[model samples]
Target: MAVVGPTGSGKSDLAVALALQLDGEVVNADAMQFYRGMDIGTAKITPAERRGVPHHLLDTLDVTEEASVSDFQREARAAIADIHGRGKRAILVGGSGLYVRAALDVLEFPGTDPDIRRRLEAQLADAGLAPLRTRLEAADPVSAARLGDARRVVRALEVFELTGRPFSSFMPAREYFQPAVQIGLEVDRQLLKDRLARRVHGMVANGLQDEVQRLDAAGLREGKTAARALGYSQFLKVLDGEWDADQATEDTIVATRKFARRQLTWFRADPRITWLDWQDPDLVAKSVGLCR
Candidate 1:
């Protein structure tokens, strides 16, 4: 089973509750939660919050390392296998749409060529996203339309070069690798925005700035992916004197709201997910029934 929704929608809490009641373990799919010492910024559930439930993949990476979706696919599947081997159901939970699909869907990742990747990366550095974006548009307009980041654009271009196919051709269909259920938590849009703003303020009060400082000292800026995470990136600016704490907090709130909307768009595109009200009184029972 997988629990998915936008951040600040209580997906983690719901996952933990369902796991506790369903005799299951949790497999994290959130990309940023993989980094250690990113607790405050990532809203990582504490041990107490986990309520003695075993959680796999949280805090598994250092801040300096980039997270690879392919690597996550392998590891998360292995973890699921291990959970089933122990006669326990695996509860996959997170808001990262692609990571969730990569873990549960019949998705195949194309092989990479170091030389091709290097050439693309060089072109990106020299000319910015315009050249690569233009190339991707000509080669794979579908992928080009969806991907805006330089790293993803380079990867898409590399895939096209290596496979002679559009990167979007490899997009996951509505098929699961294993029999599973997906539960989506839904929230009121305006209320969620307000909650997200409050959540960002809470993070700041909970010492997100200090967490970023520590991670920065540990080389967070060296990790392209980790450095650019929503709250961490904004707080890094605060530390760099680019923005004040209040500015960073507000920027984080806005970015998080945007991210939440994107997450909702991505998850809602999947027809397999069963949407449920986040405040449902029978949420646990309903989720368990869906799993059954």
Candidate 2:
């Protein structure tokens, strides 16, 4: 089983409830939650919040390491196997759409060539997103249409160069890698926006800036993936005097709302996910029924 939804939609809590009821353990699919010492900002559930339900894959990386979806696929599958070995259901949970799919779907990532990747990276750095965007548009318009960020654009280009195949061809079908159930939490857009704003403010009040400060000391800026995480990236600006705490907090809220929208878009495309209201009174029961 998998619990997926936008950030701030209470997927973590729901996952915990379902786990306790279903005699299950959780295998995390959230990428950022993989890091140690990133607890509060990632909205990572504490050991107390887990309520003694065994959780796997949390805090498995340092702030300095870049997370890879391929690596996560191997590790998460291993965790699931271990949970099944213990005679417990494995509940995969998180808002990261790609990582969730990577763990539960038959997705294959192409190998990278250092020379090709380095050349692409250099091109992106020297010229900008426009040229890369043009190349990707001509080569793999499907991927180009979906990928807007430079990082992903460069990756698409890299894959095409390496495999001589359009990047979109690698996308997984609706089939699951293993037999499983997926529960999606749905929220009203306006309510979700308000919730994200409040959540960002709460994170700040709960010492998000101080958390960034501590992670910064531990070299968060050197991390490619970790440095760009939503709240951490904004708070890094606060620490650098680029933005005041208020500005950073507001920026984080805006970014989070946007991210939530993207998450909804991604999950909505999958027909396998059974959607449930975030506020459903019988959410756990409904989710468990879907598993049956």
Candidate 3:
């Protein structure tokens, strides 16, 4: 099964509840939640919040490494197989549209080339995003088309430069695995925006700055994939003396709202998803029935 929605939309809670009812383990599909020490910023589910349901792939990586969609697909597939081997269902949960799509359907992408990746990283470090985006626009419009915006464009180009194939080429439609159900969660827009604002405030109170500070101190510098996450990067600027904490928090709220909007736009385009009003109490029963 698949659980997808905008961030702060109660998808995690629903996934956890569904997993408990189905006696299933959860495989995270969110790209950010893979990193260690990014808990508050990514809204990673805590052990207690997991409600004793097993969760795989959250906090499983060093902050310095890039966790790509391919990596997520490979790990999630193994995790699902493991759960099935144990005679339990597998619950996929997160808002990463690409990662979710990769895990549950056909995805063909190029293999890794370490040397090429290093060269592209060097270029990205020296030349900045504009030049990289221009190059990718000229070379691989297909991959570029999949990008959500400039941030994704940069990531896709980095992959393209390293693999010598358009990143999208590797993602040709081929069945990766079959999900019994695909559930999409949505709340009223105003309610979602309000929840996101409150969530940002909660993150700040939850020591989001301290969390990013720890990552920075641990040698994960700004502009790396881990640091580039929403609230973490905004607060990194606060730590760098570019913004006050109050301003950082405000900026983070705005950024999160915009991100939620984009997530809605992305998920809405996928006709396979069955949308759910997350505020409904019968979501678990409904989702379980859908899976059956």
TM-score of each: 0.96, 0.95, 0.87
- Per-residue lDDT, model 3, residue 114, is 61
Give the per-residue lDDT digits (tens) of candidate 3, residues 1-292: 8899999998888899988888888999999989888899999988899999989998887888877777788888999989999999899998988888888887765566567566666777798766777788787887665665655576577677666777767664534466457899967999999999999999999899898898998766733578779988888899889999999999999999999999999889877789988888887898888887
Q: Which candidate wins on TM-score?
A: 1
Whole-model lDDT values for every prediction: 0.93, 0.92, 0.83
Q: Write the per-residue lDDT of candidate 1 for residues 57-134, one digit (tens) a residue.
A: 999999889899999999999999999999998999999999999999999999999999999888878878898899
In model 3, residue pairs whose N, Cα or C atoms come closer than 3 Å (at least 3 residues apart or on different chains), thus clashing, are 106-174, 108-170, 108-171, 109-170
Pairs that collide in candidate 1 are none
User: Which regions of candidate 2 are displaced past 4 Å?
Assistant: none
Off by over 4 Å in 3: 117-139, 144-166, 172-176
What's the TM for model 3?
0.87
1 against 3, candidate with superior TM-score: 1
lDDT of 3 at 47: 88
Please provide, for model 2 over 1-292, each residue's C-alpha lDDT reduced to its tens digit, 9 standing for 90 to 100.
Answer: 9999899999999999988888999999999999999988999999999999999999999999999999999999999999999889999999999999999998998988889989999998899899999999999999989998988898899999999999999998878898988999989889889988888889899999999999999999999989999999999988888999999988889899999999999999999889999988988889888876
| Global local distance difference test of model 2 | 0.92
How far out, in Å, is residue 156 in model 3?
A: 6.1
TM-score of 1: 0.96
